[model samples]
Target: MQTTETLFETFKNVLALSNKNNDPSISSERIAEIRKELDSRILPETPLAELGLDSMTMTWIIVKLEEELDVDASGISIFEIFDVQGLMDELIQLRD
Candidate 1:
């Protein structure tokens, strides 16, 4: 089983690769805030919406996952997965 810390670490590793351009426009502080949220609430069953992730941020996150991790997120409906564990499952598949 993946521990909470390991899961966040894995997510961060993939996210680091998500910035293909190394663009300066990306806000490091905002990313840090998200990381802090993930650190505090890494439970598998926790709903992302419950963590204050608005649709826009979620969409951006999915886009990055698709672009950087080669994950086919096109078919995914954010409403379907509904929890951190489901997102982790998708990320695991992409990693493989």
Candidate 2:
């Protein structure tokens, strides 16, 4: 029984491997800003994942979120979830 928390952590570690952890720094405030940006720019059900997100897209999203949120944005596997709330919940857990 893998919990969502565990899945979120996995996402974080993967993001960290690429040096994209919370703005690529350790500033807590910056992380919150990043979350806001994501919320504003990236709609809950944005098809970023399904819109032909190849390796480059994945890398891009990974880098951008990591650079902004300071929290790990590697969880959720956005394409896998059935709805936006599910995806948000996963990311939120990672943020927490």
Clashing residue pairs for model 2: 22-70, 23-67, 31-69
Q: What is candidate 2's CA lDDT for residue 14?
A: 41
Once superposed on the true structure, which residue ranges of model 1 sit more than 4 Å away at CA? Answer: 1-7, 10-30, 94-96
Top candidate, metric TM-score: 1
Residue by residue across 21-55, what tens digits does model 1's lDDT show?
A: 34547676766665566555556777766755556
Report the C-alpha lDDT of model 2 over 7-95, residue by residue, as the tens digit. Answer: 44444334333333223565656555544544345443555443333565455655555554466766546556654346547556666
Rate residue 92 of model 1 by lDDT: 65
TM-score of each: 0.59, 0.37
lDDT of 1: 0.63
Residue 35 Cα positional deviation in candidate 2, in Å, after optimal superposition: 17
Which residue pairs show backbone clashes in model 1? none
